[model samples]
Target: METMNVQEHWQNMALDQVPLALAGHEVPWVREARLAAFERFAARGFPTRRDEAWKYTDLSILAKRASFAPDNIPPDAPSEAALNAWMLSRQNVHLMVFVNGHYSPELSYPRNLGPGVQLESLAGMLDENAQLPPELFDAVHEHTVLDALNTAFTTDGAVLRLAPGTRLKTPVYLLYIASGYGVSIYPRNIILAGEGAEATVIEHYMGTLDAHNFTDAVTQLELASGVTIDHCKLVQEGSAAFHIAGVHARQKAGSRFVSHSFALGGKLVRNDITSSLDGPDCDCRMNGLYLLNGRQQADHHTCIDHQAPRGTSRECYRGVLDGASRGVFDGKVIVRPGAEKTDAHQSNRNLLLSRQAEVDTKPQLEIYADEVKCTHGATVGQLDEDSLFYMQSRGIDAETARSLLVYGFLNDVIERVPVSELRSRIVDMVLDRLPQGESIKELL
Candidate 1:
C-alpha cells in the first residue's frame, strides 16, 4: 500500500486554528509549550506503519483529509434528558461535562466536592486568566506525535486536584460528548493527588450514533506517596468515529493505581497507556476489554515501568473480534536496573469469531534486574469446536452456545470491575456485540 504525505495538510490545519487557540487566556508558559509542541508535530507529522510503536495501525486515511476544528464553545448544551440517557449507571457523584472538546457549565454539577478537593474545568481556569502550574504544560513535550497534536490544539478538559489526606465519598466523573461531523477535538485532563489522598475518577467519551468526528485526548495523573486512585475510562463513540487517547501516570512510594478501560464502538480507535512506578512498594494494575465487529479496528498499547525496588505490576487485557474487524495488543513491562524485588506479569488474550476477523498480540518484558520476577505472554484463538459440539449435543442451539462461550471468556475481566452497577452495564454492552447474546441473558 502506498502512503501520502500529510505533514503540510496537518500543519495548515494547525495554522488555521492558531488564532482561536491563542484567543483563550493562555499563560506565557502554556503559550510557549503550545508553540514548541506545534513545531514538533509539524516536523514529525503523523506516525505511519513504519514506526515500531504504530506498526499495527495506520493513519493515512485520517491524514489524507483534514478535519475541522470545532468551536471553542458548543452551540447548544445537551438537554437534561440527553444527559440522563447517556450518563453512567452510578449517578451519585461529582460530574463535569464537555461538549465537542469545550466545557459546558450548563450541564455540569460539581458542587460540594468536599474539603481539600478542587474539581473545575481546565478551560475555565485559563479563561479566567489564572496562572497554572508548569507541569500542566509538561505533557506538551510528550514523545508521541498524537500527544503533541493534542497539546497543540487542546481547547478544554477537566482538572481535579486532591489535597493531602482527602478522601471523597463519591467518584469524580468527566464526560466528553462528540456530535459534530467532520470536526476534530482535543481534550487534555490533569489529576494531582497528594499524599494519603483517595478517590475514584471516570472519564467517559460518548458520540452520537451517526457522528463522523475525530477526537484526540490525553490524561496525566501524578500520585504522591500513600495515595490511592481508582481510574476508569469508558469509550462508546460512534461507529464512524475516529478516537485516539493516551493515559500516562506516575506513582510514588507506597502508592496504588488501578485503571480499567472499555472500548465498545469506533471505526478506528487506539489507546496508549503508561504507568511508571517511580518508588518502592508501589502497586499498579491495568485491565482492559475491547469488542469489535463489522470493519472496525481497535488497538491497545501499554507500558509499565518498575523504576524502584519492591514494585509490583499486573496487566490483563482481552479482545473479541467479529465479522471483518481487527484487534491489536502490544504490552511492554520494563524492570530497570537496581529495581530489585520487582514482580511483574502481563497477558493478552484474543478471540476471533469469524474467519475474516484478525488479531495481532505481542507481550514484551525487558528486565535489567537480576532479582526480578517477570513474565509476559499472549494467545489468539477461536471458539472451541469440541465444546460447541458438546453443547449442541446437550440440546443447546449453535448461536446461543457460541454466545455463552464468549461471555464466559470475558467474565473474569468483568469481575475485576469494582463498581457493581458499572460492571453490569459493561456486561450488557458486551452481550450486545455477541451473536444471539441476548438469548442467553436470562440463563446467566
Candidate 2:
C-alpha cells in the first residue's frame, strides 16, 4: 500500500466534468452543494497512513486509481422474480433500491408504512421540496481524510424521517447494488427521527459477487428526545472491490440508539462509527462483526462521547480471520467534564484461524468527569484447541468439531441482533463462507 502515488493521482486528476454529472437538474441548490463538495475534495486530496485514524488501513491502493464519477444511470427494473427472490423478504420493511449510486424508483416499493413515516430518494426530495435543510450540505465532519473525501464526491442516496409519536412495526430497507467493473460510487444518507418516534432501519450494501469496484459512503443519523432507533448494516462486496463507510449518530435527552454492523466482503474494508450523547438519560449500543479470509483486510474504528450527565454507552465488536487475512479494531469512549454519572463500556475480541492471519485491536477510555464509570478491553487469539479435542473424542471428526466450535463461538455476538430473519441468515451466510465449511458439513 504505497502512499506517494495515490496522493499524486488525486493531485493530478481533473474535475472539469464534475458539473456535467449534475447538469440541468430540477434542483439547483443540491447541484450547487455537490459542486462545493467536489471543490473541497479536490483541495484536500487523499489521506495518507501518516494520519492517526487511518494508520492501520492503508489507502494507497485506492488513492492511485481514478474511481468513476457519478452519472445518471438508466433505470433497470428488477423483474418480479427478482423481487420474490430477495433474501430479506421476511422482514416486510419499506424497501428502496439504488443501482450504482443512482436511486431506481422502479425497483423500490413503499410498503405498509406507518402514518408518520416519510421515505424518498434524495434527488426526488430536493426536487419536490425547495426548503430542505441547508446544514445537510455543510461539511459536518472533516477530522479524518476519508470523511472529507466522502463528503466531496457523494452523489445519490435516500433520506428517512419519522414524525413525533410515530412507532413503526416494520423495518425500512435501503439497499444499494453495485454492478460493473472499474466502477466507483458514493451514497450519502441522512436520517431524522423526531421526539418519541420509534423505527428500525437496515442499510444493505450488496454488489455483483465478483465485480471490481469501490464504494465510499457516509450516513448521518439524528435521534431527537425520547426517540429510539435500531440501525443495522450488512456489507457484501466482491473480492476485487474496496469498501469504506462511516456512521455518525447524535442523540438527545432520554433517547436510545442501537446499531449493528456486519462486514463480510471486499478485498479491503473499513467502517468508522461515532456517537454522541448530548443530553441526560441518553443511551447507545454499538455492536459489530467482521469475517475475513484470504489476504483481505477489515477495520473498525469507533468513538462514543458522553457529553451530558447520566448517559450510558455500550459497545462490543468481534472479528474472525482465516487464511492470510488481517483484522483491525480501534475503539474509544470519552466522558466530558460535566458528564456526571456517565457509564460507558467497550470491548474488542478477535479469533485467528491460520498461522499467517493477524489482528490488531486497541480500546481506549478517556474520562474527564469524577463520577463516571468507563472500561475498555481488547483481545486477539485463536480457537480453543481443548474444546475441539474434547468434541473429537466424542465421536466427532476433528474438522467437523472445529467448525462447530467456531460457529458456536461467533454466535454470542450474532445472537444479539434483534431481527430474527437477519440473524438466521447471517449465521448461515457466515458459516457457508468459512474455509472448508461446506466440505466439513458434508463429511459429517
Q: Please, what are the lDDT tens digits per residue for candidate 2 over residues 300-330?
A: 8888889999998999898989999989898
Off by over 4 Å in 2: 1-12, 16-20, 23-29, 75-86, 435-444
Model 2 RMSD, rounded to 1 decimal? 3.0
* Span of 10 residues, lowest total lDDT, candidate 2: 16-25
Candidate 2 — what's its lDDT?
Answer: 0.78
**Model 1 lDDT, full chain set:** 0.83
Off by over 4 Å in 1: 1-11, 14-26, 68-70, 129-131, 139-143
Error of 1 at 179 (Å): 1.0
**CA error at residue 396 for candidate 2, angstroms:** 2.3
TM-score for all models, in order of appearance = 0.94, 0.92
lDDT (CA) per prediction: 0.83, 0.78
